[model samples]
Target: MKILLDTCVWGGVCKELEVAGHDVVWAGDWPEDPGDEEMLAHAYAEGRILITLDKDFGELAIVRGIQHCGILRLVKFAARQQASVCLHVLTRYGRELQTGAIITAEPGRLRIRRPDEKGQPLTCDIQGQGSRCELRRDGAGTYRLLPFNRGSSARQTASAWGTGMWEGIKGAGSAPGSTAPGGETND
Candidate 1:
């Protein structure tokens, strides 16, 4: 599969995918950071699957109704996991991800949310205090927090999830002329 990878998942993962005969493109290879919209556009244009560690893509995909081949959103996992673990995860489940589904991988758990899935409000007990979150879309086509906390913002949480998902799809390698930092444009 032709895959566009976010920087977080490209550092050491691209190589593995390449070895497996999958063509991979890192953001650094692109001309720019290519925000969620542009990235999805490029992927769709190139007939590639987006392998990102960003949950915002989910919202972007929903709001714009963009029909991407697929999106892999990493959840949470230990940073020290073995590379083989990543290979196993991706090899076993990568095909399922091609259907525009979200695969979330935790330490020992794996959950999947389809494109048609709507997030429900979650309430958890935090040291006897009630913490609630309603994962709904706002008027601006972004996310709105009903009543969350200050410890971690929604965007951060989403990025973290993206990271884990990327980990599960793991492979390694730096694309040529695409290793520059901070989303610099190639052209």
Candidate 2:
């Protein structure tokens, strides 16, 4: 599967995904900083799954009625925990994702939003107060929920390193941290 990694998620996550045998590209590697809509279009055009840390793509998915591929939104967590959570989800549901599905990884849980429903995607009230992440679809859609505490089973961890070398090859101006990268910081 071809995957596009958003700038915020470009740190070391792409390496793991690459070892999983997926072709990955970073936003900074593109001709310019593709906005959410453009990134979604590019992913759809190329038949690639979009892996992002931004929720704005959710709105894009709804408005564009995109059905080509899926999106994987990663909720903020400790760096170490985030890596482990991502690997677990990828190993378990990566195959299902090939068919086009949206999966979200939060602090202590993972949720799958299936497009096989009757109408649009479904919305579920997320638990965990003060949670920085919530998964919601536009309307009625089926979802499979999984909850895991600490020390979950290990899945696959991509061994490929420097998968984001192209990022370094490109100038820092396009990187996520710079003022010119996106205009506004999440902070």
Candidate 3:
């Protein structure tokens, strides 16, 4: 994956992503901070996912409707915890990041917002763990669970549920208190 780490993200995250064979660019190493909007623009123009600890970028993308490849916001995570969660999400949600989405990772949970077929944001929350899980909302507004392939990564195992559930949001067991997705929140 090609990634752009915001100036606020821990510098160590860059090395971890690189070690995992991802192409990474850290804004901290830049000569100057280009400000959030410009940094977002650069990330979009370059087709890289922008990872930040800033909520302002979320406003820029959500309320201001800025075009972007993807944005992953890490909230309330310590500098040491950031890289591990970063790698975990990349492994589990790489496809969503590539295609475009605004994802907020807060502690053990993840809030993923993606453009629906009509281009309106469709938001979902995933929490829980144990085995790989698949999600779909039933007509009555309840989520129905199915099993995703245990052998392959979520992105690689993407099935027809693609339109309904997030392809492969796996467990966050690698991070403290993080678990496999078992629940969701519309808000």
Candidate 4:
């Protein structure tokens, strides 16, 4: 996989991916900031997946229709945990990402938006699961991982992954502040 690491991503986030044989490049390592729009354009032109903490790319890709190869936005706050989550996502969901999937990551769970046969990316709402949860990008380029809530429509897509899966999805035992039982409920 070809990966473009956003400037905000932790340094080591690329190490494990590189070890896994993915060609990874970082915006921070570049001579200067490529800027968000430019970076997205660069990644798309090169057919590289853009991995970052910036949720604005969602707006760029989904809302604005700025095409991209794919994107995976990590939600962990700490640097170590962020890198760990990156490796975990890549290892567990590599293939889905390869063809073009929009993935959002918190500690234990991932929210994915896959592409259709026509190769157009689907919006969260288009998947019949948009109400599940949403990642909101703040002013500083960080996303607030809203936990999944049990709503009238939300139950239709609720996890059948069981107790341990629930814990992992919620980041219950992994991180200190998060107590989400369903991995940052999408409320």
lDDT of 2 by residue, 1-187 (tens): 6888887775577777677676888786666786888888888888888888888886566556755487888887665565566667666667646667777766544556565633333222233322212232223432222112212221111111112211111111111223322242211
Local error of candidate 1 at residue 124 (angstroms): 18
> Between prediction 1 and prediction 2, which has the larger TM-score?
2
lDDT of 4: 0.64
> Which stretches in model 3 have alpha-carbon errors above 4 Å?
117-186
lDDT agreement of model 1 with the native: 0.51
Candidate 4 structure quality by residue, lDDT tens digits, 1-187: 8999999998887787788788999888999987889999999999998998999997788778788888899875698777667776777666667767788876434566665422322112211223344333347533333335655334432342213222122231212233344443332
| TM-score of candidate 4 on Cα atoms, chains taken together | 0.62
lDDT-based ranking: 3, 4, 2, 1
Best candidate per lDDT, number?
3
Residue 132, candidate 3: alpha-carbon lDDT:
52
- lDDT for each residue of candidate 3 in 53-138, tens digit (9 for 90 to 100): 99898789877888889889999999999999999888877777787877788764566666432232333334445445434455
Candidate lDDT (C-alpha), each: 0.51, 0.54, 0.71, 0.64
- Candidate 3 local accuracy as lDDT? 0.71
Q: lDDT per residue, candidate 1, 1-187, as tens digits? A: 7777775564566777778778888786666575778888888888777766677876677666777867765555443442344565467556655766555444433344456556521111111123333223446533222334435553454334223112100111012223212342111
**What is candidate 4's CA lDDT for residue 177?**
31
